[model samples]
Target: MKETDLAVGNTTVGLSRTLVWLMAIISGLVVANNYYNQPLLALIADELHVSESAAGKISVLTQIGYALGLLLIVPLGDKLLRKRLILIDLVLVIAALLWMTFARELWMLYVASLLIGATSVIPQLFVPIAAQLSNDQEKSTNIGLVMAGLLLGILLSRFFGGIVGDWWGWRSMFGIAAGIMVFVWFIIYKMLPEIHPNFKGSYKQLMLSVIELARTQPVLQLASFRGAMAFGSMSAVFTTLVFHMEQPPFQVGASVVGSFGLAGAVGALAAAKVGKLQTAIGTYRTILYSLLVLIGSWGFTYFAGETYWGLIIGIILLDLGVQGSHIINQTDYFTLKTDAVNRLNTVYMVSYFIGGSMGTWLASIAWQYAQWEGVCAVGATFGLLGLVAHLLLSRKIRLAAIKT
Candidate 1:
């Protein structure tokens, strides 16, 4: 039997490379909707005649909406047909994008951005699906590849959206995004399998089960906390970066600020093998090392006000650390309970994006108070807290072992 062609249940169907890669591409496109607004915030502010601070709130609101979706909508993956859910989300996001295209007020745009984030969670379903398809040996690698695509979508949104917004306008960017989703929706319909749900319960029970799982699982708690802090560090940097680039020695435009995402993209692509690192060392150890790298990223960012190179270097390390640990945590948490992969992810990701929201919100305040230095400080502090969290988890595990 071919390794990648092993049977799943009573069927001969298995993890085909083409199928996995296709899922990755679709996942990338779906997730890209949430981030297209990041680099365009300044442009939108100017066009709509609002404060940059007010404009930045849209990013925070998007993340919060995403967290809400993760908590509310994603658990349905375990209870409903995933393909149907994905298609429904795609339709909703397209509608939201159209709303964004014609929004004439900040509140209108804010509501549309929130809806876009809520519906753009379709890609997240792919992660659990990828995990379910692979055997234990290949789980991390497959997840890493899908994650690489998702990360690319995130980084590339900034790059592409900045250019689109610069050439056209922020409204035009959303209009274009809506058209792209129409094509993506058809592709998803053709490619996705109609997998049966693992859970058979009322919506209330399914949700209660998620809470029960969270309460019982210490691993889930530790991993979620780590993922939260690591991602918060990255989000703070990315959210405030555009504002920084508009200042002082480097008074570049949206396209240039967005181009810096290429550095983070480089980090994300390089860290795709982090799963192998987790295989070699332990998963938690890899997570620990990643947090250290995350903290170290701040040193470069602190000096970013002086030179563009520092910001570029900082983005590379920051993304490497955050994305690497994220892959590790994501893969490891699924091992806790196979039947509840979607719920497990729902918990992990809800925390992850909440951290992201907090980072964006706090960094806005920091930008006002201490500018780039404060932003760097906030990012580094989250990394440090994650490192400390790892130490706490390690001690807890050791103590539990001793008792046993």
Candidate 2:
């Protein structure tokens, strides 16, 4: 329950199941702010008198903001009081939500989204806290549990956003989000244990450390690149899904688009449960399996996009692939740096953010040219790229394993 107790020299502090779940829940709610605008983009656009194309900037800007935060803020966790930092970030997020609720112009929404993205760094804080609290042996498993909640939040935030927007209005969704944030903030304060800093490195040293990590760790480099590519594929699929569903062929409602969260749920759950597979089979093998699913899912679009069941199956497969690959990547990366979790996270998350941005940008362009087919092509292309990366690295990775 106390930070000092966890400092018992590499031994776990014996966290209760209830405590862990409570922390994960709070972390999930705080992180959900980043995606709240995504499902409601159409509604936000209409209210602000912009086209859907124009409203796409919301997702773009928020992602940029998140990337900036990952670079600027997450590194502080290694040197700061994580509980206090998380609390402060939560307050900032609440203010950003309030700004979103009151925004009268599209530009105002964009600015608020930037702040929301920056403050939604709470999830990053929880990752380090989770690592610090766990024993050496349970590190991956604990991280996986927290990641399951985090990914579920990332997936379901859109569902909550769209449902609230549909039932009330777009602005009301932010107001409701603010209320939820306020409540979650209270829970977080009561539940999360304080984490004493283990490394109080200077900013320059931290930045340099991340660079050194990039250079020294072959697995980190490959995993980060593969992660970015895989996420880019997913982003391409997600960014274009609304457009495809809203237009002529499907004409689906926002609620239906939001229901993709169910597929995400399946995927997150699968990742959390497959820790043994990742540990035994290795990151590359799991990534290979996930990539195959991604390829199959994209190919399924040829037959499934028009049919209800087919669409559902495609989404399920897509979510499973993306989430599974993500788990493997994170589990592998975290193992590389025992003492510098923040730096490791900073590098990995930056890749993730970059990938998401590229995917979104490409999806927009692809939609303009080849529509949904183009998006699927992009997804499959990334999967193939990942396959190649894995194959090229296989010999080296196996050699490194034998040496270890």
Candidate 3:
């Protein structure tokens, strides 16, 4: 067998199971920092003397920072010592979190938020490492396990942040997040093994190669586009949901807003199943199903204009669809270039974050004009676009399969 094929095949079976779990835990802690400020946006706005619209920029700036990190930091995973990179990034993230806690003005907070996003590439590093280490047979399951940790981390950060911010101060949430990072940093140092360089080239050449891969890779393009659209739509809903819940008839508290993350968590559970389904249904068909579910989710929201249960059901369905599509996209993209995981990630995630930021920005404006209906319309429109993209690509995708 070819060397890359051998690596792929051997990566799945008979690995150190304990180490797998350890990586997942460490990765989750590192990734959770990205979402810590989300649920507390309203609190941050009040404390920082910014408008809610401006505070919403926190989410955008953070995502932009993450995109930059994915572009610059993640690619180093292929060229440098992965363990060292991860450790350094973790330290940087903690420092950024500390700065956020002490941030006295808008610009300071913006700078701190950017740094936090930039260094939060820890999860990206972890996923590629897990893929590299797994045997082929167990690769998907291992990836799913690690991702489940990630999804849980994303879901719970909001809950924990809300509770901590409510009980103490908004700054306390960052302090707690920083403390968690400190603990995880040590655990990673002791437990995670170092990775050797895979692509030995100058930084310029490495970057050029990654760009070329992104430029030519159809699967990467397709997955990145689909992933972004789905994420952007999801971001639109989430950005507006808190405002809706906090205002008007609902008047829910921060804790309750944070609690809605549970629905997303329940939806996120579907990611693992999507991974398994990929082997059976093929990536394209699975994406179609996910898009339909996403659209149907928005339809539920229309009914939810008057009822909380309707909103809850819509949120759950929307999350499941979004999370499931995300897993499939990652799996598909990973298969495109085994050795170029980090760069592939940079390309895919840069596009993904763009979608997320756009969604949030547009959602904010839409919320102003159309309220909940506007948000739902944007989300449903994005889903429809995705469905159309998939159908147009279907023939070419089939041809590519035949050639393979």
CA displacement after TM-score superposition, residue 217 of candidate 1 (Å) = 0.6
Off by over 4 Å in 1: 1-13, 398-404
**Location of the lowest summed lDDT over 10 successive residues in candidate 2:** 1-10
The candidate scoring highest on lDDT is 1
Residue-level lDDT of model 2, residues 238-271, one tens digit each, is: 6767778888767876677777777777877887
Superposed by TM-score, candidate 1 places the C-alpha of residue 99 at a distance from the truth, in angstroms, of 0.4
Error of 2 at 235 (Å): 1.5
Evaluation by lDDT, superior candidate among 2 and 3: 3
Off by over 4 Å in 3: 1-15
| Model 3 weakest lDDT span, ten residues long | 1-10
Cα lDDT tens digits, model 3, 8-92, are 2234234477877887677667777877777788888888777877888887788788888888888888777778888888889
| Per-residue alpha-carbon lDDT of candidate 1 for residues 1-404, written as tens digits (9 for 90 to 100) | 01122123436455778878987888788888899999999998998889999999999989998998999999998887778888888889999999999989999989998998888887678898888788889899999999999999999988988888888887888999999999998988897777767777789998998898788777788888888998898999889888988888888788888887788899999788998898898876888888888899899989654797888888899999999999988887787645787889999999999999988899999999999889988988889988998987865864674586
Error of 3 at 359 (Å): 1.0
By descending TM-score, how would the candidates be arranged?
A: 1, 3, 2
lDDT of candidate model 3 versus the reference: 0.79
User: Per-prediction RMSD in angstroms?
Assistant: 3.5, 3.1, 2.8
For the record, the alpha-carbon RMSD of candidate 2 to the native fold, in angstroms, is: 3.1
